[model samples]
Target chain A: MSKYAELFATESRDHLTAMEHALLELESAPADRSALDALFRSVHTLKGMGGAMGYGTVSTLSHAMESLLDRVRSGQESLTPPSIETLLQATDALASAVAASTTGRESALDISTLLTRLAVPAAPAQGTTRVLQIVLDPGTPLPGARAQLIVGRLARVAEIVRVEPDVAGMESAQFTGEFTVQLRSAEAIEVLGDAARAAGFVSSLVEVVPRDEVRQTPLSVDATWNTGDLQAPLQKYVRIESRRLDGLMDLVGELVTMRDRLQVVASRHGDPALDEAVAKAGRLIGELQDGVIGSRLVPVWQVFDRFPRVVREAARAAGKEAVLVVEGREIELDRSLLEQVADPLVHLLRNAVDHGIEPADARVRGGKAVEGRVLLMARRERNSVVVVVADDGRGVDRQRVLAKARRLGWVTDDTEMLSDDEVLRIIARPGFSTAEQVSEVSGRGVGIDAVLAKVRGLGGAVEFSSVEGKGTVFQLRLPVTLAIIPAIIAQVGAESYALPLTHISETVQPAAGALRRVQGRPVFVLRGQVLPLYSLRALVGAAGRDPEGQQIVIVEATDRRAAVLVDRLVGQQDIVVKSFDLVRGMSAGFSGAAILPDGTAALILDAGGLL
Target chain B: MSRQLLVVSVAETLYALPSELVREITTLPSQVTRLPGAEPSIRGLINVRGQLFPVMDLCHRLRGVPGNEAVDVLVVVSDGKTLGLLVDDVRDVIPMDEPAASVTAPDEADTSVVRGVGHSGEMVVIELDVPKLVRSSLA
Candidate 1:
């Protein structure tokens, strides 16, 4: 498919997702006019864009859906569950059609039947008139022609009650590039805006006087009031295909490699002129690469926006009173990473509502507020994004986890020896559920394992801290970008290896006296903590004995630290991670490979793999 | 006409590994860091060039001979980064004509390691299945 088709598909899918989420929210609070308006606006926008893209199927489907939303927003018809379900089905159909169009195939989905079912009975005309103030951005050129075009467009949707400045005086009046148009039709404000934008004069628009606001004002057709049409602003963001971004990243990697080669050549020949030129070029290239990659990062809010409705519906399904509070939604992360994290966040939110939050009666008895709060907060840390999903309800019962672990044979007779963190890790293990009964939502002993895997797959870490009666917070620490990592190159016997410095807890030169054997395992005492030592040589199957004296690199994986004994310490370097799987079979302990200075390959150690 | 053969002596027994499987040749480090709990065939890991790669002892893994010899050469052969096999010596890259394949095991040799016996004029060249050899060593 062509790139433009992909862009259209992405934009349409986003609009559909927004529409579905808003519909779900409106289902619970049928009287919420803002949500209804937002839902109507999304469908209206989709209809117009689909028409422009020549996706007739999408346009028709969205037009039918928009008509239904108009009736509901105008309070002529109440939102019922079946109505919401039909809307969702229509959304699903639109999404499928968009997907099909991008693949160069026509969608055969017919939503006319469902749309016909949502049609509201027309009410008798009672001579009620509504004024829609059209506001154009002052910077818009051809003001008079644009105004005429907007009026012509509105005539198709609603009867013109009155046009301010009286057509002839339109040019001389202090117009402020804004004009009011009184319409006699019962069409929704969103539909009106859609009609105006279709004419192509409205910019940065909103309905300042929403239906609810108009209802509050006791205006019987002759109400003299200032009503300005809010211009719908052009979308500030554009969706780019991930594959294209990945291709760009690959080119950048090649550029970095070439840069390194140039530096090496310049340094080896001791050419000051060449060195200075290469250095200058390298600095500029570095900034360009960073800026290019940074452009791909989107705020976490893009994903978080969908969670409010998810939480609302999930809470209702589980018969619980829960409120979802999101903070730091503006924290930017790589788009791919954000996509990867969405599922886990949804799972956590579902669990919070289904299991963590108590029902109203239970909450009242426990002296907690009836409305439980699940806060999903994200923030930027050094080189990582830390997201925490915290729920204010009954925290994880440690006793139950221990009991479950015992019953599942995950923990041995030496149960006390295992730390709380280890016990919590077991909870993330497959088929380990602490819920008393399997609930349809989450208690079936699934999702957590997948969540853990996804987080780890993104080169991130997940940790859980709980207070029995208070709540449970699952914190996820993820690298800001997956394209690069700061690594320390070390020698394991005769081979050099790179270990990501993020996972390196500390490096210690343990003397002979500091090494001791505990239970047949080598342990090194550093700062009063006994860290397990794994010799890199033995782990990698090198032939020969380890040198008598060697420095140990203490690395952290999951929540524990282990000392990796290496032959010698090579200097640290920022390495571009190249996938090991692409080459052949999975490397035993190496996460990836990177080319080092002086033009040689370095095997990057996988800390998680070592665990 | 005599067929050319690449020969390496492991514990005084002539063994030939196809030259195509050899990725590169490097000098053995002065000391190999030993991982205590690892399998016996896994001699240790070594830093070749600047990358730390796993080095498998072909002597212990293939021949079951544990020799502590100060070796000058280590053949760094790998399917990828995971399995880097260190051989005592990489003698030569030779071309051999098609020879009759017959099962003939050297004394105390595991049959799994030997593909077949091929005659290179006077010398019996043993064909090695590289992956199979590594798997058996790992097992």
Candidate 2:
């Protein structure tokens, strides 16, 4: 048994119990964010430890289950009763795997079908579609063939969505020159027309009328936030106790509230200097909060730089020559998150050296470089940090994995070939390597399941792509969802509502007639950006306690933004968010609840759902 | 063994809840933040000692009597989840024969949440299944 096996097993048992507890809690309150988060954290930590301890089957199973959970956290999928049952069964299988892995062996349990059940299929492509009507000269020869040629020409610039009467109908004797084609693309109408006419058939007008978007004017309201890069290595502090920092944050939160009240008082006084000072204090407070919060998050390099040393030792152990390459070292993650990921990352690096890289003699026979190249890179992608662990070595043996999967009744007899993703699923099955020497020869099946699970628990994902005898690339993607931050509390009706300050582009009190009716829907044009206006009165239906002034908060999420009109602005404050049970009936737009300084609970709005 | 029950009034009808199941009883605050899209029987939520508890109006929940503001709240626990049951008043805590007081009232027509209707001479109290009540209505 490995030196870390006992420690890993003990920790894993506790996490498993916690995960089951969270799962049971979820069964009661399906929308409990804290429960879901706890469940994800436990799964993630276990996967990391399992990988670090060199337990392949443990990691594999953990990864499969984590993918399902990641989908649920990102709102890409939901937790149904059946899925919950599958998860419970997965927990039991994982517990047994943990027990078996302590002895350096895979669990003799076949859960490939269960793993398959956990997979969330990819979403289809979304693009603006347009319909083109082409009328050719009445006496044109081979009109159908001409249409087909035009479609093929247009395919270079646009996706050929559909053609009227289908391909067979276009080639039929009953075909007409006026058949319509639906094309989805980002090209200009003139470009599409030219491509259609380039086929050289006489035509009436080659105009493509766009489908569905002509009635309303286009709105450009997606005000994306730019979290600027971490500046120079200044004297930001080597280390500080997190509890003390939390205390400092609380004091700052109070200062922010004081600033809000001060602004109101200063503005009422009509003194420019006082107002300027108050505004400056607000800006300073915002910066201070961001800095303290950012300080709590350590850069990826803190943990990543240690991996090269791990790879060096691993390569030596495997009798292989390997070089480790690291990039995007400055990407920041919550310190605890970075710590949890380090162990799994080490396992992946070692696995690459011991299993992925070929022996020196084998490398020469394969006509490849003497030293295997391993890359550990991190890049921020929208709301996630994608950390890729790729290696230039012999890829996974798909044939062997598929055959094993079939024998385990994971895939049917007719299953012939497997995609890179399918190969991952097969390798992650708890019993994939239980057949002893089969796993030892196949390469790259060790500790992968647990690594996958841990990332999923963090509401992240692992994407696999490989080529036979070439190499394998594994991308671990994790969400950088906000934990604690400043929020703008707006009074809507009789309640105070908190919106994450990051999601809001700006707040404005529109001039009279600025909020116009476009097709009977209220919209506001702000500095040339069109934003849809949603009335808080109409949305929440809480009776207003006498209006003071209406304020519109421009909230943005992904590619959508909208103006939420509230009773008035209650100013900005740094809210200390505590993990609380999800109040199921608190409505769809609300993400969770927080207690305000005045001792009343306020619902925190989810910007994504609001838009 | 004797079963101890805390008797309370909801729209003037006497009901008994097992004393062990009751966490504590407190006066219902006048103001409650309305939870949007919640069931009609839910009289919104109240923050008691920083912990928010959804208040269930027993008057409307049980008897279909709408819009009655309950005076007292019976804070209760069911399956680790806590809720405040709004009632008009808490009459008393009385003890009765364990099995005898738990028998189905002979004249009772329906048993939706009523476990039994117990009687002591002319005094009667309807014992409710707390878990059943939470499951059937709160959700």
Candidate 3:
């Protein structure tokens, strides 16, 4: 990896995230000044960083976005839904530019079209009443011709409503270094300010003044207001790379591991002097790790902050009326997991908007509120984060799923013997689409499978449940962090393996008499329910005859539990996971390999891989 | 008109695989893991030092009698990673001059086991095709 690649990755990711959040805010309260300001700041920072990093295309595009936002923020222009659309497009272009920069490829960011759209005059009805305010620092000597040119450029956007030191008044007295203008135009205030700055003015100030204050009803026409004034100082925020945070996390992981090892050694030796030292060290490391990891725990709000815009656009596209309610957005997760989970979460939210929510008329006919409600919730679970997307509208039609499965030959006479969970699994399969028609937003049968695959790929699990005529709920459970995990070490035949402890529901030696044959598969009665048993030796391709008897490790994959029989239980140990590329055409029953305490290599079994 | 060859024995036949393909020679482990549902030639995954690698039994792959004894030497060749190939023994690497035209195998000869026959004076060197041998064993 290049020395700066990680920095670029982290910085660009943060910029994208901030841009997403800001766009979402803009979609809802389009007139919210603070939201516009935040969006402008994010764009401005991205442009600055991109320029510093020699990503010229990204810098230029973001610079255009910054200029547009400046206009919107200054009240020189009003934010329309179309403008928000343009802003979202610009955000996408910025993301592409960043992607190109990181990959060392030149990106052609054709942002001129979007910039032109943004520059288009605001709708006649929503135009802002322009105010021209000018302030010049006493330190600069302003040549007369340049000042005149500055004043002339401002006149194009709004009427030259006011010019300090009227031509007759200027002859008698030197200009007092500052002036203000009260004019009427719906354009954003920052446009005028940027125009002044560009015109070689030493300082410029611009703000929207009320039409009533101007005591004039401005005609709904394109006009410019010239107010020769100095602009106020812009607010600035610093951006940092996430790798620095990750580096800190790495140190924290090492500290925690060392602390655990020290505790083990101290307890085993039981020396009083060493006991005190280890105790102090353990406390210090615990605090340090928590502090470091806590620094990387970003609130779920970062993800949820983008849903309002998605719901709005999706609802509009689908001819539906929907309200998005987000709760527990303050719940924080590891920053890395947050990034991976964001896309899938957005997809789920979009699905809820496009498919789960019914049209206002349909909803009313169903005795529901005209507006559909989609709720996004995040919460901390034991060592994991649970993110839920739920909608209050027409729920999934199980009959349709069953019909489709039957038509696809996925269901048979024997499938009638399968439970509802098994039927749902079929629907989740790749290429399974029940929608009668595809929509622009979703229903291509692509994203859901990707969502499932990604969640599983990240070692997380997704659960779906729907109540007909009510709504659908998708619950995603993800590990709090991916850097480390608690795993159980067990011996399969002669080789030892580590299985993620999260998947292990419990381990018990099934009574020899309790084993029963169910559909030609060996199963054991656990709590009065039959659980399938798989031989670890057979799964791992071990040699020799199967052991006469073995211990069973019952593991859970979503709602299903399976008993994995191994020759011996070697007890549990937390092993650091190491990834290896799967050989082409290799389908061995393991996810990756890890090093054991004795430095022997052992495969780490994937619970989901078994499925 | 001229040829160079190295001959090795599998069962009673003399086979020649190009010297360029012979990567290295080493002793194989006494015990081998048997992957169920895998081909007979695949001795299964093995731990070589601290790394996991796969070992293939050449005799079984070549359709010779599968040896029950621990392999005395292992020929490690790279097909990506170092694959351990169990061989009976290494014969001398002898240079040869071209004799008559190469001949096709007879019905009794395992065509799948031999690529072609090279003649050098009174000795005939049967060329071993590793991929074909592996495929036939796997099939």
Candidate 4:
């Protein structure tokens, strides 16, 4: 794979996320100076990265986005909600274009739709705002360098509102020996003329003013740049390929297992020096593993930062005013886990906006503030991270939801009044929607089941609590790392397997007579609950018969729980999850494989797939 | 122009893949872990110098026989992903004087996975379609 392609893809994604965040911020604050600066920088970086990677389509798309944001920054274009929506769409197009270029697949992504919208004339510049056109002498050695010198001198005298042929274009010498620099300064033409003359290399300078002589508001260039919002210094960082990091982590994973083996060996031998060395190695391996996993730990903000935009879009689509307040974004999570949950978090936000939050008038009539609030708060609780998406709007209508559930045959008429948890479980079922018809906002058939499935796949759990007419909160409890998860190792037949502890509700040795066959399916009854039983050996296609006393591990998925019968419970330990080649298309019901303490591989059972 | 091809034997049948596509050939890893739900063709994952890549059993793919071979593996870059092809044995790298002949049409069931068979002098080599094999197998 090309390193340039990887870098371009990653950098472009970061810029797009940042741009989307800033666009949402702009939508709320409109004239927030720092937000505008952030938007401009993100667009600028995207343009530079795309151009450098030879992705002309992506670079051109970024250029269009940059120009649009530039107009908004200069107050030449009104930053209306619709305009921001168009800009967000353009950002998405740029992201897709970059993804296409990196994947060695030509995308049919046409940016013409966005470009045409962007080309629509912006509002005319206010007042005497004029662009100073400077022509470098034909003999100038480096027009780009000379242009920078001229702009630097002018910035001291006036706010450099916008520069024609942005830094990347100028540095690449894409410009002719002449360029235009728009400036907002109170100084007269002659006074600003002196500063331009001092920079030299200027063959000539010309000023073009708008017909309207109303002086525009003074620019906030100083304040924005001084805040380091525009001129944020590049932090020192080494861009190590994540592949190399992953390789190192894999080696560390092996080391961790080997460390356990070494401990066992040392305990048996009991040699003083050997024990000392083994213990020291174990300590070092633990440190190394932590270091590797720590490197993959990224602040939740990386994913959380995107939610405001999602909430804004959902609010706009539903014609409601909902504010997303994210907390505990500083909490860090494994990079891979963070990426996996991003989609689910986005869906939850959309659900919160579309279903939980009411429109402004409705909310106001309910004696609440006109603007609804969607709180996305995350915090560390003991071992797992808890992310709650709570919306202070109209909560889920319990009566409507229960009626819908009964109609769909999800619940019988004889069923008792459902508890909050039971109601949530019902709503999360696939194809369960209380909405009368599918709307663009929330109902398109696929319900919260997809979200639960994803979270479960990542070894996480999703829980919800709601009160009618008040609010609803969807709580997602996720493991800190997807790479190494705490799993209960169970031995079935001659092979060992691991089931994520998160999926296991309880383990019990069902009495012989407790096992019953119903419709040719074996099930185990415990207390009052009867669970479908799966033979771990038979599932893995092992040649074996039922053991004398089968150990049943009760595992829970989204809507069902099953009893997984194993020969014996080996023990519990942290396992390094290694993904199967996805092309293997749903291999026997295994979620992933993990390295055992014995340095062998054991398939991690998918509790959800069992049922 | 002579084309250099890496000749590999799987289930008594010889196949020729472009040499450039073959990243390396190494002894089959002893601890190739079996995935639970993976297709039989995928013999699970093997860690080569700390990097884990999925091992594709060539015999399972070609002849529908389980590849129990403990021989050498040819690591090939197919569709930009590195995967191990479990070959019974890795034969010598040979040069063929002409482009692979198109006489042998791809199997009726799957058109793109196996390219036309080729004759390398006395050796009849089934030219393996790397991209198509990777795409179809992985998917």
Docking class of 2: incorrect
What is the per-residue lDDT of model 4 for residues A1-611, given as tens digits with 9 covering 90 to 100? 46446645656656777888998787666657898899889888878777766788778877887788777667666564345656766766666666667766534556666787666643333333557878888878878888898999998888888998888877884678778888777565555667987989888776653324422422222121122222212423345778888778777877877787778778998799999999898888888888988898878887897789899999999899999999998898888889989988888889888888888888878999988899998899866888899999788888888888888888989876877778878888887787665779767655798988888788777777888898998889898887777889998776888999877888998886878887888888888678788888878777668778768898985446888888999888778888745554645467777777656677788776565
Better of 2 and 4 by TM-score: 4
What lDDT does candidate 3 reach at residue A167? 53
Candidate 2 chain A TM is 0.39
lDDT of 2: 0.72
What tens-digit string does per-residue lDDT give for candidate 1 at A1-611?
Answer: 66457557667767877887887776555557888888888888888877867888778878888888777766766564445656766776667666665566654445556556556443314444655566787677778778888989989988887888677756765556687786666665557678888988585333222345334543232121112111222444477788989888766766776687788788888888888999999998788779867977888977997899899988998888899999998899988789889998999999888878989998899999999999999999998899999998998777778877888888885686445578567887888877777777776556688887778777787888778778888888998777777788899666778888878877888876678899988888887889887988877666678886688998886687888999899777667766522222333565557766545566677786676
What is the Å distance of residue B133 in model 3 from its true position?
19
Clashing residue pairs, backbone N/CA/C < 3 A, model 2: A44-A454, A56-A447, A59-A449, A59-A450, A60-A449, A60-A450, A62-A453, A63-A452, A63-A453
Winner on lDDT (2 vs 3): 2
- Model 4's CAPRI class is acceptable
In candidate 2, what are the lDDT values of residues A1-611, reduced to their tens digit? 44346546666777888999998887655668999999999988888777776688778878987888999899876664445656776777777777666755464545566567667432213476766677777878988888788888888888888888788988888887777777777565556668878887847543332424533422121111111211111222233677886667656655655565577678789988888888998899878866766766767987997888888888876668999999999888877678888877887787777667888889889999999999999999865688999888988888878888888899989999998768877766665663343333224454677776666544345778888788888888665533455689988766887877756879998887778889989898888777898887676667755375688999864335799888888878766453333334656666555556555666777665565
Task: Tell me the TM-score of model 2.
Answer: 0.44
Candidate 1: clashing residue pairs, number? 28
Q: Which prediction has the highest TM-score against the true structure?
A: 4
- Over the stretch B34-106, how does candidate 2's per-residue lDDT look in tens digits? 7777777787777676567788888777777663656789988887777789998899988854434447645
Q: Highest lDDT: which candidate?
A: 4
If you score just chain A, what TM-score does every candidate get?
A: 0.64, 0.39, 0.61, 0.61
Interface RMSD (one decimal) of model 4: 2.7
Q: Give the runs in model 2 whose Cα sits over 4 Å from its true position.
A: A1-484, A544-548, A578-586, B66-69, B96-111, B120-122, B137-139
**lDDT for each residue of candidate 3 in A1-611, tens digit (9 for 90 to 100):** 35354456566667777888888786655656777777877888888778867888778878888877787767666665446666776676666667667667644335556556556754534444444657665554543444556677777766676766555443344666566565555555556667676766446464533436334532221121112101211213235589898777665655665666677778889799999999998888778766876777777876677788888888898888998999987788888888998889878888888779998888888999999999999888998889999999787787777777888888784454444466458767888876667887777656677887778777788888888899988889988777667788877667777888878889887786767889998888888888888878778767667666678888886677888888888777655555532333354556666555444456777886675
